[model samples]
Target chain A: MTDTVHSDSAPPNGALPGTGDENVTGDEKMWTARVRRAAMRTLPPDKLLPDRQPSYVASWIYVFGVLTIAALVVIIASGVVLTWKGPSWWHVSKVGLFFNSIHLWSVELFFFFMVIHLWGKFFMAAWRGRRRATWVTGVVCFVVSIGAAFTGYISQQNFDSQWIATQAKDGLNSVGIGAFFNVLNFGQMLLWHVLLLPAVVIAFVGLHILLVRRRGVVHPFPARARPARHRITGAATVPDEALPSSEIETVLHKDPEPVR
Target chain B: MIDVVSASIVNLTHPGHYLHWGFIQLSLANSIVILAMLAVFVLALVLPFRSGRRSRR
Candidate 1:
């Protein structure tokens, strides 16, 4: 398929019309319309789910973010099945046992892919070009995911869960949140694992993605382009933003220790 | 259905070596998971993406 859209080439903060922090308007005073207008201006449909991305975005490192989301989908789907089956049902029934294992492995993959995505973004300085909120939301999602995983472990109706809860409660108590987030109580931990934490993670992940869409992917670092020693001595090459996809790929492939 | 926990019996035959330092501790299996993530991350950066050409209009 032909690439339908050109990238939001310039830094989205300045280039996109009416996309700046203040997009003033009048006569649409009704709260709902005002919000709708604001949303449309900030993120038009095309941008909210763009068909085209910059050439720099095609690297394998970018795939981890989608992998993390895919793993979360499996985790949520399997968790729903496991929850519907009830806690003790898995111990005896084959189908329930299979779903439980699926849920468990999906959580493992979620964290595994999430950490890799984080590492890639960190090395790329993903917060650049007015994208700090995007990066912060991703960090919050990671932290909330850890909390969800902890609650999941402590919610299990097994010896391991009991051991973890009994050991964890003391540390939580010292922090003074043990009363509210009581690890020792299976009902509370299960509620958090299955509901509250997941909701927060999903919401934050959604917001993080929206922010990324609003601001295009961070531009490649200027430092990555080196002087072509043979082409013209002492004349530094231009940044990747101006290059076509093929040339950009060549630059990326020839990167001398791209991750600093 | 096989017990997921019982799957560990395969590894139990070769008891895992573990490392501990300060408040951090990890079995060989856990260490391998971390090291594998790092390896994958490095490979992701170095490996060429086929879709690079597709970025062109």
Candidate 2:
């Protein structure tokens, strides 16, 4: 049997692609119209449905994530400076020393807020719905982040760096990982730390944000149903906004009445 | 022959530093910080799934 391919490059049934006519004779015409509409809806007033705003926005605890991202930006800028001079310059030159200091401080700040961001997200229980993939991706990123930081620390030509590299290898070898990752290999470790690991981390972070935007933030806990007596009594019900702040206390000391 | 040569090369180049006590202290501190961060990261990742499942339950 011979196969006949339909090639209708022109608008079908004399209908323009934008018109989205049912009688559009070609598959391309149909798909083009749909895709166009999708693109259009993704822009401005006729946009795709708006997702719900996070319920935790007012809390100061949320600031750590933004701070972590800010520190990462600094890290990237300082890293670019070091990359321009090459790794060896930082050990000798004054300008290099300044940039190195800035990079070190940036890493410290990044780790500080990153830890906070991770913890805050966890306690907030932000990973609800079909969000396990986001969580898993984030976990993988965390592992990668550790590797990046390790390689980064060793890449510094300081006494600390030299000592750590030699010492850490023993532990790694005992665990059977040293066969693949030789900490003493400066060239390989430098590239992996500075370029490869950061690239992977950034990619994971991008995916995490996309998934979050798609799914929307989880709501705070539902209101507790009061007992008839409590409703009758002067015992006022706590507001939903107080949920996250008081979660620790509430978990530690069970309320005499059921929470929900 | 190769093993003997490589061993000799190592002996000549070696700095002969045992994992110094200072380095051990630094590593321990770093490991604690890193471990805490790891726990937090795992918790953050797992939170969504846990809440999702909890709601279903």
Candidate 3:
């Protein structure tokens, strides 16, 4: 009796909405589908409010998003400490040196998580649901992150900085931005990396998350039995060759049986 | 009295070894403060998510 009740709460075909199946016969399946549809309808896409909580592309990989945010928080805190002591504090105090080291490590971790997060989003094809703005904002944030890292490296008062600055200047010159943003100026780089770039990065990240919460997760690419036209945006087909394997395996409505 | 005054001025001008020692001490101090902070950060990230499911119930 409970089995039937549970099944009823499930969607038709026992598949979740956006999981690709369109038809079902079991009463439980129908009930579940109705519930799911109801939940989706409640979320209005017009203002960036999603009706459902975002699910993971997979459970194992979900924590990395939190980890990335955590790392950023660390970077900011360490940066504050280092800044509090002042740039020359490193030369004058033992504690200052340690803070600098921590700051360095935090930045490294931040990049590690940032790269993984970007890749995860792309593979999920999360740019759907009129989320092109989110996608573009993320890409811009990525570019800014690179800038922040570059300026940070230049600010490090070491031989590596000296060599990188001279080498990097040429590349920057070719683009014409170098003429204005001199990489060699320690004072300028320090201020930009510590203050200006962080503000930009944080703002963009906040906006990206707002959109994610609004649209919910991108539906998994359709399964073989389902036509791509059934998706939210049927304007273009995700070519058989174009679909990423991980997404295909995870998202398709087919039973968990081996694809082989 | 003249000699003592001259010696004091010289010592003030060249507080030689003490200055280098101060820089090293500052670096060590910075490291300790950062390590403690990093530990707290790691804990915060790990604990909240682990406990979130249980707390939601």
Interface RMSD of each: 8.0, 8.6, 11.6
Clashing pairs in 2: A127-B48, A128-B48
- Provide the DockQ value for model 1: 0.38
Report the lDDT tens digits of candidate 1 across residue range A26-56: 2234465557667888889998877667656
| C-alpha RMSD values across all candidates | 9.4, 13.5, 17.0
Lowest lDDT sum, 10 consecutive residues, model 2 chain A, at A251-260
TM-score of each model, paired residue for residue? 0.77, 0.60, 0.55
lDDT, candidate 2, A104-180, per-residue tens: 88988787777677676677676755567767776776788889889999998777898999999998999999978
For model 3, how does the per-residue alpha-carbon lDDT over A1-260 read when each residue is reduced to its tens digit?
22322233545554554533333344435566667666555444543542223233333234566677788888889888877777689645768877887888888777666666666677768686567887888787789989988888888778778899999999999999886899888888889988999999999888776765654446565555443433322333465555555656444423232111
| lDDT per residue (tens digit) for residues B10-55 in model 3 | 5545433321364554444356555654554455334534212211
Can you tell me the CAPRI class of model 2?
incorrect
State the displacement of the C-alpha of residue A242, model 2, in Å, after optimal TM-score superposition. Answer: 22
Ranking by TM-score: 1, 2, 3
Measured with C-alpha atoms, the lDDT of residue A12 in candidate 1 is: 26
Model 2 segments more than 4 A misplaced: A1-55, A229-260, B1-57
**Candidate 2, residue A218: how far the Cα is off, in Å:** 2.4
